[model samples]
Target: IEGGLLASPPPHQYEFARLNLTYVITSKRKLAQLVYDHKVNGWDDPRIPTIVGLRRRGYTPEALQLFAERIGVTKSDSWIDYSTLEGCLREDLELKAHRGMAVLNPVKLVMTNWDEVMGVGHLEPCSQPALPHAPHGASSDAAPEGTEPPPARHFTIGKEVWIDREDFEEVPPKGYKRLFPGNKVRLKGGYVIECTGCTKDANGLITEVLATVVPDTKSGTPGSETVKVKAAITWVGVANGVNAEVRLYDRLFLDAQPDAGGKDFIESLNPNSLKVITAKVEPSLANALPGQNFQFERHGYFVADRVDHVQGRNPVFNLAVGLKDSWGK
Candidate 1:
């Protein structure tokens, strides 16, 4: 727009409220039905395209900026792949987000030798660098100086720890490196443990995993290299881990071009788009603030709930994006 004798807009000017990157745009006529019919929680529902919706969904400004640069503005219509937008989010948060461990499907692992090796009710201190390392070929200037330990997330490990259920199997799958009877794996940043067996309920469900800790093999200490393990699994101590409400959000539409070809977009709505689960996270995450981002170690990137997350009380988070593109995989 130009301010002259008459203020006038430049050629081909239009209102650009939020950047549109090949996603379906809801018509203004149907906005009322969406709210009245309870199809969505509100206009700010994460599934929608409103400004408040995007912010609540943990879509960072940098990610959107990258998305715009990726699929530039064009006059001609084109069906862009939806995964392109998700790829931008993963790239942006990989270098910036804090690192933490969370167990979405938790199973208890009992260290049977805890009292014999350590104390009876001891909790061994364990720490990991909050921002472990940057992406390959990125600037190395952000690294800490020599012998100065990087910023650490302090937590503890004890007789009982939580592990993702997927990391263990009773019947060995061809070449699984994770926990099984007679298999050994490191409890990341902690100690090397050897799985003895597991206990099952009357319904044939595995209830508890039994493992013995290898003495004097904690990571980063002398004799820590005495045992060699192929896989190291991330875990949260039962003594210090906190319970959190984590909502796993996925794509709203199963079809890439749900609104195209005069198709009924409502029919393509993904039924399993959202899943809420109680998760066990390390103590460091207890202080995560609204709009803050973190890489949930093996899981993916997540953001603290903007509306529901309460500091040191009722913790909640929403899945922002996965660590990799899981499209059609």
Candidate 2:
């Protein structure tokens, strides 16, 4: 068999290399089964371990390189936890990714005091640093002593802003610092608001949270830094926010080693792996181009879907990964 094609001898042959990334299967037959059986959306699904999938999920080239360096060359087969890759991505993006607000599970927050300050239908100006931790045009240590920081970029606010539903609690849990009756919280890049109460529907679901804005507490304004709050929350102005479809991608399999011990991998499929939700994003995000990545403050890193995103139309985003300390063991 080896001598049949001697006339056209191969120039070079290389040994096959393998990566032992945990919680992912790289078998060609298994991957084909996943696509054909429709267990996953497709071969490029963000939940899969394919290169195309990783690219679509906002994995950067530098991050992948860092991962390879950390994993190094090894003769023996060994497994690396998925979190190692996630950490690499975080390190790569921490300094580069722009900061933006996106409320995945939004709940209405009506500023009852809005009309008092800005008048009815008026849009209030708000600003936030494009990159929160990193200084603009200068490295953090290079800034001269006693010099003020650069101003943040501005956005608009209205009578209402949408906050993550999880930020509020009808019954406060221990150490909870977010919104509740009489609790004051600063809206990131906006004003400090004191929760008066909340309105509920017949079904006992919170319809809208009513809050009164603290006087002269708009961020960057006089007295803004003086008024301290235990918690600061992210929000998107209802009038200025862009509605987007965000897909939260979690682990495909619940078991860490699904194929270990001769177990059938299909049986370990996680049913709640992908969740589609409508998110309220900042107006700036409306112009997000395909493959643009952002850190959705307090939520996770997400990217505009390269395949489905369309400018000036409804945009689709996929979650890349959450904060390192976000998940519980």
**Model 1 C-alpha lDDT versus the unseen true structure:** 0.84
Worst 10-residue lDDT window, candidate 1: 15-24
Candidate 2 residues lying further than 4 Å off, grouped into runs, are: 1-17, 135-153, 325-328
What TM-score would each prediction reach against the true structure?
0.89, 0.89
Give the poorly placed runs of model 1, Cα more than 4 Å off.
1-32, 134-150
- Provide the overall lDDT of each model, using Cα atoms, as 2-decimal numbers: 0.84, 0.85
Cα RMSD for predicted model 2: 5.0
Candidate 2 lands at a TM-score of 0.89
For 1-329, candidate 2 gives per-residue lDDT tens digits of 38576655556765534776777787888888999999998989999988899999999999999999998876666778889999999988887687789998898999997898778899878778767665344664343357665344567888888998899987899999999988999998888999988999999999899999887888878788788899999999888788999999988888887777788999999899899988999877767889988888998889999899886697888999996645446
| Model 1 C-alpha lDDT per residue in residues 56-78, reported as the tens digit of each score | 87889999899889887766556
Instruction: Give me the displacement of residue 27 in model 2, in angstroms.
Output: 1.1
